[model samples]
Target: MAATEQEESLDDLPPSAKLVFKVLEYNGPLTQKGIAEETMLSARTVRYALERLEGISLVTEDVYFADARQNLYQLTEPAEEFTASDGEEATCAD
Candidate 1:
């Protein structure tokens, strides 16, 4: 299906949060710093996005195995699940 940005499952989230979700969706788990670098968002914004996603159980937060001070972020399910749950369209790659 040809999906538009508005058709994404993260419609209820801010664009930055959706972007963070997409980043994790495609790149697997990454540290907050990695996410900030990847999305070009500020650290604070990334934190907010993670908090939002976690609140809905759409994302998971874990301590980085290699780093004691940083946290890793990743999606809880496949891209399709996010869309399917919201009755929207999956907008990310496998």
Candidate 2:
């Protein structure tokens, strides 16, 4: 039997992975070392979290122009943050 097409949400990821995701979401692109330092996680742990995020297609990996030896990590898109005027509820179309 084959697996289903259902996808996992951010809540399904581990705490470390969630921290890594948030770090990237706020700080923009960063290298594995940078993420490790920012998240205060061990290199091995960061690598593991990154692998999980990659598996879920949450974060993207790109070659670092300044240093080819490292890869930069960033979110696929901006985090879901929107502010409405006068406390109005925002819509997707707005």
Candidate 1 at residue 85, lDDT?
73
Q: Give the poorly placed runs of model 2, Cα more than 4 Å off.
A: 1-6, 78-94
Sliding window of 10 residues with minimal summed lDDT for model 2: 1-10
Candidate 1 overall lDDT versus native: 0.84
Look at candidate 1 and give me any clashing residue pairs.
Answer: none
TM-score of every model versus the real structure: 0.71, 0.76
Q: Which candidate is the best by TM-score?
A: 2
Q: For model 1, how does the per-residue alpha-carbon lDDT over 1-94 read when each residue is reduced to its tens digit?
A: 4454335456788999999988998999999999999999999999999987887678988889899898888888656555657676757566
The lowest-lDDT stretch of 10 consecutive residues in candidate 1 is 1-10
Note each model's CA RMSD in angstroms: 8.7, 6.0
lDDT for 7 in candidate 2 is: 71
Q: Tens digits of per-residue lDDT for model 2 on 1-94?
A: 1232137767888999999999998999999999999999999999999988887778999999999999999987634456466677756874
Best-fitting candidate, measured by lDDT?
A: 2
